[model samples]
Target: MATKTSLSSDDWIKAAFRALSSGGVQAIRAEAIARDLKVSKGSFYWHFKDVPDLKAQMLAHWSSQATDAIIAAIEANDGSGREQLRLLVEAATDDRNLAYGGVRTEGAIREWARYDSAAAAALKAVDQRRLAYVAELFERCGFCTAFSRSGANILYGALIGLEALASGELADLRADMLALLAALLQGGDSSQA
Candidate 1:
């Protein structure tokens, strides 16, 4: 039996992240987290009203860090739209770690969103923000409105695909991204060019 002890809300949140990352959202159990933290289940109740509350808190935490932060930084950068778009591609592709979550986290959150209404709504908000950021960058790079929007969709799809491929041996998709970036920057109409 696990010993009863004090556990902070942060501890539960961290455990929730690990659980979600490893086994998807269904793996998040207050009891499991309490055990992992070497505390009584009461520790969890002290921080969260119940499992549903814990799940909501965890999803919000993930969305804020994994989606909002990345989009905000890309939007805030003082560079040309093309430059920002290129940098965003590099940031999303490069092995160089930064103060953000990876594509896998995004994938897991997407899975969570499929079954949870609140998670789905959060996912929609994150997607809208990310698309807007990408569109802004593309527009700044001189692409037309339709081209920018289409480019955002294409780039996002490519990123998710590359992330899945990265789990195998297809090392880096940087070259492909650069090629796409070059074309977009040159005003290659994504629809017909």
Candidate 2:
């Protein structure tokens, strides 16, 4: 239990996310998070009805923060479809571009989805929504139906790869992503991975 402190639902959620990232979904247990945060389990119950509730909220938070919020922001901004695509890629790789930003651990969440039905469903919805948005943008940019879909898939897959596998400094990865994005948009060779 946290000594001499008060914690909100958001605080518990943040701690849960950290736990999830470092120790996988199993680490999201309420008692574990409370211990990690040095807060009483009562504090957790105050915010969530139970572990399942927290998991549901956590998935909802992940989807909204990582997908819905980002898409809404990009759509609200004034820019061409291609420019929006660039921004989308930028936000995915670097949370600094977002207003409601925090440490991103979608890679861990994706791994969790492999074992948990709720997580899997949430991830599926996010994937479908995000891909649909990308396909729409590609269409707006004048890509043929097949090409636009292929472009969306390729772009989304590349972003996921970077999230899961890319190494090196943040700056280097960002630069490399930009180069890859350019090549992909131009439909040029990108076999140098």
Candidate 3:
């Protein structure tokens, strides 16, 4: 059990994410999270000004870890764009990406966005960033601008839909995504096709 003095802001954020994953945004109450963490509410206050502050910090942390960090990791390797695209799909679909306590944090956050404007905005920003990056990868793979954008939209939309599906229902989403990637790459300049 972590004592109040030993708890960090990251601990509070992670606890809040777990609460959000299990029970939605309303479950992210500081007191509830503190109880879950076996710490007092004062510990939460020590790291955040209030619940809203924690919520803001939580969104920022999620964005940094879930989006920015993944992109950075994918870029660190000197693979070709096609290889990077495959890596991106693998990384995105990897259970370790957003799974927390067997729940998809991305799904939870998307659900939270339905009621929270901040969450919705954050989601929109993340989506745009992802789409742009995917499109850039396609461009690097010799796709035209329009084709690259369209491919990014199709691939990203499918990914979001797959994430919403039950795990048992997805026979092999990663393979499906890779198949889609191969098809897109084969199309090779949609305007000419």
Candidate 4:
């Protein structure tokens, strides 16, 4: 175990996520994480003002690692928007590509959002950003604004729903997500659908 003085803010945040994945939002206590980290609560306080502050930082870290980083990576590759969208689908469903722990962490965060205003707000912001980015990709694929927005909503919604339903291996889920992406890409314009 690392010494208290050696623990960084990211270490605390990651331990908190592990706790969240195993338990729930209620389990993300500084003392509990400190215990798990084999550090003093003073280590947690050294990095955060309090538990709420840690929670806020956790949310920020999650948003950056999950959404922002994925988008940046996808954009870094040279591909048509259609190709990029396909990559996005793969990344979203691939358990190995998960930013934090995996589906459990996402599920826990969503569950926390149900009753926590800050969590809910963070979720809303992340959703909006994801939807907008997806919509932009759709537009680049020749879809009109309305169709792009609609497709984004459907695709993103399906991803979230799949995450909620996910357990153990995600082979079937990846296939299902790829099939959905193909269907969305092949579907006609908004006027026809």
Per-residue lDDT of candidate 1, residues 142-186 (tens digit): 777788888899888777777767645474667777776776566
What is the C-alpha RMSD, rounded to one decimal, of candidate 2? 4.5
Residue pairs of candidate 4 with colliding backbone atoms: none
Error in Å for residue 41 of model 2 = 1.3
For candidate 3, the per-residue lDDT at 110 reads 91
Worst 10 residues of 4 by lDDT: 94-103
Q: Rank the candidates by TM-score, best first.
A: 4, 3, 2, 1
lDDT of 2 by residue, 9-32 (tens): 767777888887778888889889
Runs of candidate 1 with Cα error greater than 4 angstroms are 1-11, 93-103, 169-183, 186-193
lDDT of 4 by residue, 37-141 (tens): 898888888899999999999999989988999999899989998999999998787765343567778788888999999999999999999999999999888
- lDDT, candidate 3, 1-193, per-residue tens: 6777798788888888888878888998988999999987878888899999999999998888878999999999799999999999988878764424332577889999999999999999999999999999998888888888999999998887776673447547787788988988887655432
Residue 49 lDDT in candidate 2: 93
The Cα error of candidate 3 at residue 129, in Å, is 0.8
- How many steric clashes does model 4 contain? 0
Runs in model 2 deviating more than 4 A are: 1-6, 96-104, 167-172, 188-193
TM-score to native of every candidate shown:
0.77, 0.85, 0.89, 0.89
- The 10-residue segment of model 2 with minimum total lDDT is 95-104
lDDT values for all models: 0.73, 0.76, 0.84, 0.85
